[model samples]
Target: MATSSSRIGARLLFGIVLLFPLTYANDNAQFPYALTFGSSTLTASWFTKSEGIKAIQFPVDSKYRAYFEDALASFGKRIMRRGEWHVMAGDELVPAPPDTHNEDTAVSLFRDAAQQVSRNLSATLGFEPTYAALTLSSVFNQSSTKAATDAIFPNGMGFIHSIKSLNKVAPAACVAHRLDLCGNLGRTPAECADKDSISNLILVLEYEKEYLYVDLVFVYSEYRTFPSVGHEMLREFGEANREKLLKSMSTYDYNRKLHQTLNAFIESLVERQLIVRVDIRAIVVAGGASATAIAQLRKLAHNAVGNGVVKVVDEIDPGLATAHGAAANNGENDEEIERAAEDENIDDDPQSGDPKETCNNDAIEYIFDEQQPQTFDGDKMKEMYYDKDAWVSGFNSLMMECTKLYIFADKYSIPQLRDDITSALVGHSHGWGWWPDPDIDIIELVYNNLPSSSGLIRLLVLFTAYSWSSSPNVIAWKDRFRGFHPEYLLDVLFAQAQLLENEIHGEGGIPYDGMLNSCVVHEHLELGEEECRERLAKHSYIFASLLSACQAANA
Candidate 1:
């Protein structure tokens, strides 16, 4: 029995030696721990219930489990008793494709569904179901994609589920496609020193672009050409109906409140001759309600002589607009727009009903030719809202306040609180999320404020996931600015493994966010299970783990 024990210990030590070089890169390595003796059998004290595993949780997914088992198998790992499993494969005990790396989240889900089966890999059909007692129990106290993390991306990566996959644009990404058109300026001549000049207007907004575009929207100088800043939208009382045009500008707080000012938009469209004004049924409408606003304006051009009509011509390449405008202005410099923005009154401007009481002047600032001469007429030049009648898919048309979701918890019972936090995590893979706030708002609400076990669970789970997601985002964003680059992840993981190990040695570990959760790795490994933490910090593993989390989120 003593010899047998020595043999097992020798292999484990050998495995750890073999593991470090390939797994941990660019960091000072820690020597292996001394194995306990006097007992003939391996015990559960090491991996499970160790504080280290709770910090920087490891072996993020099935791929991780696979690597560990493969490594242990070479040393003839196995479970000779209950409450344990082992890594036995050298003697044909376990076999998996050697080169197979679990780079995809699909591996985890392959075991998630009932009646799901595949000899190799698949989700729902091949993986164990989430509700399975064994699976849930295995996940109970572990820090893994399944155990601790929550999806942080709004609409989950814009739309993609996998981390390697490209993220879709946010709904607000349309802000990038924003454009403002001006008319009734044919005789106004591009403003030289005037803020309303077309050249200056173009210069302010066209700060930089690859191509220049000049859309000369022509209209008779005789009519009042509305400066198309905000879309002057019309409201509908019923199908094919147009209400009075709203004179007031939309509020940034609720700029999408089309329902409030729909009537004004439709009427103004007709008034602009962009659409036909007719009875809802009588007007030959095409393209559904989306075209209703435009149809009203088209009707205004009928027999009226010298009526205002909008014509769009290529003014310049969109790429060169800013550079050319800037270079063209001999007297104006970069500070010119800032000066104009600083002096211009935001509150009293009749044309701009934008309710943002004060403009930061620099924060998203731009300039363009002031549409219509700088006459302080009580009347607005002209503004148009976005296509509210179009499919306002998601929350486009509603500038709604954020929703607040609060789950109650007492200040005690930290362990059970963790379980509840786990339950919340399971459901987190899907959901629209709360509104009272921004994405990180809830963290502020709960963190440090909760004293109960349950609250700690919630706090830890959310804070960890939030922190984890940030690493990748920050890493990805480093190239955008100076001194912001994230070093390659290889070094990062090596450091993480060191941290988890030290924390485990300590009685309790504060999670990545500083809450204590029972460490399960050492205990589980003692029960013939392989460790998962080191693998989590691996480039391939973290990358793949994020992919799995993303996939689960999209799914």
Candidate 2:
């Protein structure tokens, strides 16, 4: 009795229903395993819902270790050493025959080694896992690497890689950024820029079953031990200077290029609406140089994005993470599984209010003295307690007091008090003297007590940046800069750059006067603009002259 279209729709629905169980069955039957190809070792892992995860290392017998080491040595000696000067041409390097031939041979040798390891793993497990995944070290060229992997695992899922596996293990709504810091061969063009250079070298040598720091020097294209170079440097230059040197090295061209690559990838993903910035939660570091790479990448990420939330996960067994991650990627839907578990634990009762609501609706009650009955009563009370004249006489004590109050307010969850203290402190910083400088104590207090996102912190940084030229105290704090939070220092540098940029463009310099605008430092909570303005009207007289100057400058 149904129409032709309705009959077609019914048939399609029935077909989908019938196929659903078959698809699920296939997923259940899938026993995915992964093998990670590394310079010194081969790592394999398999995952099953019932069994969880099982990982094994190849070259179980010490003699077999030579095979992997020789393959890697050949890759470095033949491909990397020669490919350094070669040019890329549409996925093919020019001067093709010899270099290309060596590259293929190197990849094949590596693959053969991996296959032997896989066979051993399969034999040990009794049944071989058919759905296999493979992840290669950064030294392997992606185009050639894919061919090698395909050959190793003919029925492989090409899209499943270590990074995807890392994402699977990471917390929800977060993705992983892989930073492979290999030993011999530099992977990308950026890493290859300074091949085997000692300019910014860091090494961890395996000796007597313990990893020890190795400082080496490159003399006439050969590496030689510098012999306690780090210790000597520390003794000569002191810990502070050594730390500074290390920090500077983190931004070297190789690391800079890596950071830029990561930034570009993140921005592209954002542009494509694939992921937001917050979704980039972890930088999974792998390889022999992981310890060095993590420190450098942490600094770079902090500089690039202030890195408040992003974590740098140290993969102790470097290549094993990739193997385990790949094995976890089988036909299973990790997200869906997690979602289902979360749903099962969720309460049936609806939440009292939207948890994500940004605005605090609780009314902030400001009780005024009945005898005084003034609109600016709160301001007057703050002035009386902190003493405005004392701040003009010597701002240190007042600054400290205000900072403590701000910290207290933050602790007690009093946004209104925090806002009031912020406005008062900023106004005083401008009016106290020509170049009123906050000392190291105040800097430490704000940074230590409040989070980096605090407006008060931003205000203090801006004030420091604008006043640095005239403020001798701030200039003198250079020695103590290392003690300051890295994020705080980065913020200050950015603030200074912004002020300089404003001057360069003939923007007539930063409007320090504009900072007097109460609303700039005020927290309105749930109040509408009109309501916020009405509330702020009471304290408007406090910065009337400064606000007038700001308005005139803008006009």
Candidate 3:
């Protein structure tokens, strides 16, 4: 027994040595904790729950179990014993795939579906298969001909999911990096075999030479259970019968909510000439679905856009397809996704209520005579206009236009245009003689439209913070605060903290206007700078307290 234990320990140590490199590699890689669906981004913690066998049934008194438990403890892993199950069993548990208040799941499904379609199309057309998930816009806005759309190149290498094989993306061989289980917790090599337990729906696409499989999963509310096992059945409804079903919503004997969601989306696309036709072979319903529910969905899908035969299968792990597929393809950049959306035109803009164009300002507009007139030739170009109001207006307009252009470029995969616009914004901010200060209105406009990832957004925030620090009266601080997103506010505060910490002095030791204005904002409802001082002090204290609590629990 002693020799056997020594052998086990030796093997465990060997496994650890083999695992280090994988751990180091994945330590820097980012996982998809949040998914974007239309305008909303939903958090998905379940997608990344430490990859290991949870709730493994082991003998309560087995000496091997003790050894494994000790190993897990060394790695800071908790083991749920049989007795603990009794305690936890009584506790009300939230269902799997927690966040689903918005249309995130639906959008995720559509995005993956569209990408699969694009891949098939690429193969058919003899183009390189793209790995990126298409944006909602790209699916709807796809050009009528390959010749027209094919001219534009793919933005960058995007994340791709091996629908048929999760291991292709996750590489089950790297289980050591996935979880620190102290060399698989003393389990034998046979015991640690890949379970392939995750639920997923397989989508098979037939190409000329071979078949491609696209696995999918839907994130549905576990709380919303089907009323009966096989009570309701829904058939496909097309454009011809859509109005009748929508108008008589009360008479519908199906999952009306799900039906309407799909109905509205398909209707919107078809109305805009985006989705002319769908050749969907299968629409598998999985994850907390019953026979009746699956049938009902099939009917709903049929009625919504039922042009041809669409089969609906009831399968397990439908959600796995989305979660695993997304995790596999998490490395895709924003531009590739945007281009996909632009081409598809599935995701509509709320403000514009139209398809976002892939082409940039220059591409859309023709220079009839580029050399004819050199406007503001030589002498006039050098005249530095210091009109604060004019500068503010012109720069504000430029930012707004750039904001649009930048978003356009990002969305349509026009990297060149995006880079040009970013350069222009940065150059204009630094080089131009007059400091262009955008007032509350312009600030709000950019904040609302531009994504946090945008370079322009960062520049605007820094400039605004500095402007507020330099001269509080340059912009209406109070009004601006009312419209600023919480994220924007937090970013500004973080910037302010960094600026103050660096102690970069202005003309004097006096506090800069940006930091001062930030302090003033915090100091409101308090005497002098009391609130501001408390905020700075409390930030660190609060974080420390939380960390201590986490540590205590771990211990």
Clashes of each: 88, 0, 38
Model 3 off-target regions past 4 Å?
Answer: 1-384, 413-416, 439-442, 472-483, 504-555
Q: Which stretches of candidate 1 lie over 4 Å from their true place?
A: 1-407, 411-418, 430-438, 452-471, 475-555
Cα lDDT, all candidates: 0.23, 0.42, 0.32
Winner by TM-score? 2
Error of 1 at 522 (Å): 18
Q: Candidate 1 at residue 16, lDDT?
A: 20
Strongest candidate by lDDT: 2
Expressed as tens digits, the lDDT of each residue in 357-429 for candidate 2 is 1111111122211122223344543443223444233345445555665675565455655665655555443
- Tens-digit per-residue lDDT, 179-274, candidate 1: 222222222334322423222111011101111111111111111111221121122222233322243433332223432343344456458654
Rank order (by TM-score, best first): 2, 3, 1
Judged by lDDT relative to the true structure, which candidate is superior, 1 or 2?
A: 2
How high is each candidate's TM-score? 0.15, 0.31, 0.24
Model 3: C-alpha RMSD to truth? Answer: 23.9
For candidate 3, the 10 contiguous residues with the lowest summed lDDT are 220-229
**Candidate 1 — what's its lDDT?**
0.23
lDDT for residue 346 in candidate 1, whole number 0-100 = 36
